[model samples]
Target: MSKLFDLGLMVRTYRDPLAWLTLFVDLLPIIAIVFFGWKAIPLVALYWLENLVIGAWTLMRMLGTIAGNILNLPIMLFLGPFFCVHYGMFCFGHGIFLQAMSGNDQGGAFGGGPVALVEWALGTAPHMIWFVAAIAAVNGVFYLVDFLILGGYRKTQPIAEMFSPYGRIVTLHVAIILGAGLMMAFGQPLLGVLLLLFLRVVFGMALNMMRRLKLDGGLPKTLDPFADMQVETG
Candidate 1:
């Protein structure tokens, strides 16, 4: 580990085009909200969509980590099916709830029965296509930032290194949910949007700090992946 933080390195790294693009991708949601107006998109729906996307992404990363470290097999065995079933139900249930809240008639789309319920649940995919695409783009940019800019290939970082992204995802979701709640309570969704933008900036900084710490070997050598699981499950 370096005795001192290298400010020069930080400055030079941030000046790279990939770094700039990463920042832009990180800020995309805020930019979109500002451009379209806060209420133009459904805040709750967007948050739920992000939850689904992030959950799936986390599962994929966990599987990749497991592939690299056979010792992680036990954790993978437990979590793989768990997350799939949990997130599947979570997404479908929440999608239906949101549709109901918006007064979208799913029954009419599928002839009004239990079959219709199943159809509506499955139908969330089509409805979420654009939001899912936007989130996938953001995640793709983050992957580039991790691999190309953040020394992911320099040496194998611990699975715990994945925590930073997970933390950011959770934080963004909470900020949006709380902000939207406040907006409804006080009739100021624009204020909520501004709050989300501010939180995104803070989240970006937090991620940068994590990357720097990893570079400096300041991060723990091993962190219990179970701890991460607890955070997600709780």
Candidate 2:
């Protein structure tokens, strides 16, 4: 474990192109927040939409994993629908909570369904679609270039792919909650937003690194990185 703390191993994250792409996608919102005057509410909406996209692509990853390994079929058949229903409700409930938080005297959590969620998100700041699109496009690039072209699916299991999005999701949610607390206490939205973004980027990269190091003799084969919530199954 001491070797895992090595500075060189951590700094090597800078050399990872995929990691850099992830960072780029994660940080683009800063530009929006700084130059375009984005607030925490719209940023929250952005992340909510990003969660949906991640869920969508995770399903694709599971399919790709199944395609690579026929043995994953049976479990995929059972777990696939279960994951959909569970993750959908999870997002739906979270969306309601978010709408409530940002809602006015009209009331909170008054949404009918997913359509309402999307409407609420876009209603806050329509321009966020561009950020959302950038996120989706970047994720698609990873799906195509890393997972497909590089045969990442060949190395990973369906179970790992299924749990993949949760690490980032949990990390961001925790950061948001902390940032929200800080903002509420200080009444400083800008400070909250900056801290939130910083935490998100650091934690996101760390989680991905932990994952990379865990699978297929990751850090044992080579020195690697870490995260607050280590989603490393291996």
Candidate 3:
């Protein structure tokens, strides 16, 4: 009991530094989108949703240490789109709301066309460059956050002291590339989300497993397997 209590404290403390870092890192893309001049609101919206989901996941992982709300595969899977849509709405609505408040025509001048997009892109090229730079600079936010969150838990154990949430995100890019390749190869994008969700679950489970085995050094051999199984698997 004392051991468990101490462990919990360590995990919580380790997450503190990470939380501060994460808050700062989280602001970059938003700054990029706004300052870089959003060519299409949807792209900006995507970044916002992506950032939000990552933040939520980080928070949940921290809370899980004591609360044990360890998100299983299905929850992350379902929440992916929900998070995206939620963030999209938030970004777009905020833009429109501000525009309306300032007395700009509700649906003025921005036509939907490559030419318009290109023109907007050219106008914001410098801003877009800054946005891209910001993204590159802060790309490691997720991994750093994950590492700090888990590092908190490994405070006393043989557990790996560092793991990056961003590291796991590699799987996301890989999935996107692979999905795009498949779409080009076979001409279907329907499975992209499903594949991405599958990868997220597998990646999450792998991280947890690594933490358990590499970081925490696995369950004690003396601990009864049957009882442990009952606790974790039952």
Q: For model 2, how big is the CA root-mean-square deviation?
A: 3.6
Q: Which regions of candidate 1 are displaced past 4 Å?
A: 1-13, 16-18, 38-41, 87-131, 144-170, 181-186, 220-234
Per-residue lDDT over 1-234 for candidate 3, one digit per residue giving the tens place of the 0 to 100 score: 122235553454345553334344434434544565433232322333343344344434333333222443355455545544554444344433323333442354244432333333323334444443343444345334333444432232111111223333344446555655655677654444345445544443333333333234444321112222223433
Worst 10 residues of 1 by lDDT: 220-229
Top candidate (lDDT): 2
Clashes of each: 0, 0, 10
Model 3 steric clash pairs: 11-152, 11-153, 36-127, 142-166, 143-164, 143-165, 143-166, 159-215, 159-216, 160-215
Please rank every candidate by lDDT, starting with the best: 2, 1, 3
Model 3 ranges with Cα > 4 A deviation: 1-163, 218-234
lDDT-best of 2 and 3: 2
Model 1 C-alpha lDDT per residue in residues 1-234, reported as the tens digit of each score: 131246764675475564565466556655446564534135445655665666656665666565456776787677678667765665555555555655675455335543454444334433345545766776666555654465343333334533423444456557757776877888976777677667766555444544444444554342222233333335
Q: How many clashes show up in model 3?
A: 10
- C-alpha displacement of 104 in model 2, angstroms? 4.2
Backbone clash pairs for candidate 2 read: none
